[model samples]
Target: MPKQLIIRGVPDAIARDGWWLASDATLPQHEPPSPTFPILGEAMKRRMPWIASVVFLVALGDLLFWGYVPGVSLVIFAWAIFAVACASRPPKRRVIAPALLLVLASLPMVEHAQLLSFGFLTAGLLVSVAWLRIAPSRGVEVLGAAALRLSASLPVAGVKGVLNCARAVSHERANGALPAWFSAGYLMRNWAFPIGGSLVLTVLLVNANPVFERAIVQAFQIDIDLFSLMRRVLLWVGLGLLVWPFLIVQAPKAAMVVTPPKTGIKLGLNAGSVLRALVMFNLFLAVQSAMDVSILFGGASLPDGMSHASYAHRGAYPLLITAMLAGAFALAARPFLAEHRALKPLVLLWLAQNVLLTGSAAMRLELYIDVYGLTYLRIYALIWMGLVALGLIMVAWQVLRECSARWLLIRSAIWGAGALYVCAFINFAGLIAADILTRATDPTVETQTDWHYLCSLGPAASKSIAQGTWPKLQIATPFWATNCLNPQPVAMNWREWDFRTGRINGYLAVDAKMRAVRDEDPVGR
Candidate 1:
């Protein structure tokens, strides 16, 4: 007779005549084995064809386009997902938005490719998974949830699953694996004869004719660096891991919305004290506002030996920081002052004044740009001021309407992302070149144009440099000859052919023709 022992939360062992009997079944079981146990191997076996196809597509893209334009990699990644979606059972229609967005994101590769490509790619991937797996009605909330899960799920399950799948394939190969239509041996068998025959014939022809051999060798000279190939392969594998989880793992069905419980406690500060503080703060801001109006707008004489440009330069960045601080104070103070009736109106007035202060900061930057000439930094500063103004407005709306904090943060983040994405596609360097050239030519503008700075603006400014007549500007003969006259040929494949670079090349050709005509003439050319 077997002893029926109830050992809760302990190992299944029993004493019998001073000896313990043990078997594999004697081990304590925390939970029953899942029917779908060994999910990684099973899933990989089922999806191996699609997975291999995706990896091949990524590798092909790396070979063809990755060196030329980084953004092209994102497009290839999106296409991989699209291909996988097409293969999925009962295919997901919802992935279209994110896939299309990712494709649209690739257009910047030809114009203004930059570091933001990776971030844009990440967001697109998250959205792809969220849209297909989560409810559509969740809207932007899905982005936040997807972002949260991304960090936890991506590195943990993805790398492990891939390694396990590799192990499974190895194990299967060792144990007489079942042959599939898409198996490696099948593909090799089908392609071997044609590929081998073509190679043999090509080699024979190459040996027969020197011209043919040279032409063939030169035409197909794949300048592939072994180290670069390895680096790109590793990067593709990492990207593959990122994408694999999205296809297999389920996204959060609903966002975890945490509503803070009402504390029933008002702000810690007394109404009178807070009101008094605001009154003093407003008075201080009023004095600064008055000074700005008089000095910046009214064009009053400087108090000492300070030039107008000097005053403008000194105030530009500092005043921007001051305005930012004022804005931050208002945002931080709004919740505390919600119960105070008189303070809310005062807060609104304070915010409005801060907006005016931001405008003054912008004017200061513009003044500095006029004196020192336009630069990438000045352009970005102006744009930043505009965003700050927008942010202040959003803060006011949030406070007054009692909007959800999460909602406000998500919206603001989205706005910032959209702005960055848009900025990435814009040819700001061209605009700067145009502005600088225009300023240089204007009779009223006496400031000497920074030709050195213009040259430093990269290929986008090449056309402007080419268009300028050097003799009138009294630019250095050596500098003019080296920079504007002689343009170096930019070697690029089709993928790296940017709009600005293409235009620059056209200008260079025209400039070369002009130089030739001048050389042909005897009129002091």
Candidate 2:
């Protein structure tokens, strides 16, 4: 017999293959069937209002506080999460973790480049909290579920919520009593023809007589910018659309779907094959590590054909990419090879070597920067290398503990993305210029400064470039040619303000003014 459910006081046939009846149902008055998904039906019902309220409250606070004080916005966001915790009534311990992370991650929003990083980290936390509220005891699955929910929620939830609302409205209109204003047929019958006729008559009369058209234009000569009006409407509507689903419903539950294995392979790999691969991979990494240690660290001179800086620069990027691949392979392959006792130690040892390799990559990049001078990419590469190293360590821990590789990956990806996003907003050109200028003043240090690169750091470094005295006149020419010193000022609202831009513009304005005064009065200088 097909699975049967009483939907809307009638027995409905639900398909046998895990298909569910999604209709509204009423149980007996004496005792209702306990919710199969209590986290969704009950926990969310209790917590969603709080979550939604906090979301709007934070938005309001952002409007009021952001860019006014660099630190204040972070505090307000934290408190908004706190208020959410109180309203949801989750345990203090559970609420504290995500709340703390949100506040800390939000600190970087004071800088512009960190916005994507902040979005990813905060999205992860919000998803995690929503999952925890529904199913707090799922252990390792919580992290995976949170990852799944976050990945799914962004693109799927809003559309689903919209459909849900439409369905609700349709059902209510069809089955329940409706007010006259909401009845579509009644409205069309009563008002549609009259409104249409009025508009038609008005257009015809305006075209028929020049005098009437002039009178109408003068009477309705209000200053209305349609573009501005449309933009405001879209802004609030877009925000509402983005947040509506989250407010009305809970995120996907851990139970809604099964978590797949890291590799997704059901069949076993041969113990011999895995062992052979690990051994070969380890030997290859060993050779590379040995070479790096010898040439880069041991003071061994490079071959005549290659300069040390050139050799170092070539490997800096590729080696880090290699280490990242190694971490990924180890995570994916470890679960399959767990039966082999020897593979575990070898895997840990391999990851440790990759960490060392990452360190070597960082050293090489530093050497490259020392020779070529700093650019934004070089500085960010160093930061990324650090995160890659940390990720490798986490991968090793996952193997040692036999924890879920998926969990390790999810957490690592969150942090790595956050790091890169945060790095994006840094004023690298200004920083490089400042550092180079400081170093050039020193008589002891010997290094080439790339003034051309400094000038390319955009208007942010305008002040440093305009005022700096350089060794090469060629480098100084571009600064004058570009007129970077007096780039037009842009007025930023509180939402768009950030530390880097604020400081850059502030310094540039002051320095440009000073330069102007000094030029006008050389004797005073």
Give the Cα lDDT of each candidate. Answer: 0.68, 0.65
Clashes of each: 0, 0
- What's model 1's TM-score? 0.71
The residue pairs found clashing in candidate 1 are none
Worst 10-residue lDDT window for candidate 1 reads 11-20
For every candidate in turn, the CA RMSD to the true structure comes to 12.8, 14.0
Global CA lDDT computed for model 1 = 0.68
- The residue ranges of model 1 lying beyond 4 angstroms of the native Cα positions read 1-44, 65-74, 89-92, 135-143, 151-158, 166-239, 256-273, 437-452, 469-481, 484-489, 514-525
Q: Write the per-residue lDDT of candidate 2 for residues 1-525, one digit (tens) a residue.
A: 998866574333443332334365444257786533322333335445744674585466546553353333443444454455445543433555555655555555655434454564456446544543554465434555555555557566756665765665565556543344566888999999999999999999999999999999999999998987786556555544544433443434445443444555734556677677789989998999888888976878888899778998899999899899998778656755667889888888889999998999999888887666677778879988999899999988888887774578578877876676656566667688776665555556577555556556666666565455432233323345454434544466654566766776787677667767877996994
TM-score per model over all chains: 0.71, 0.65
Q: What would the per-residue lDDT of candidate 1 be over residues 1-525, giving only the tens digit for each residue? A: 999988675443444332434443354447865442243345456867757765765576566555565434445556566566445624433556765765665566545445665566566656555555554565656565765675468776667777877777776655445344335887788888999999999899999999999999899998888998798778787767766665665556667675545667555556676688778888887998899899876877887988777887888788778777877777556666767788887777777788888888888888888777778898889888888888778777876787777766767787887788888777777677777777777778878777677667776666666655443454433456375434454565665665657767776787777777877883954
Work out how many backbone clashes candidate 2 has: 0
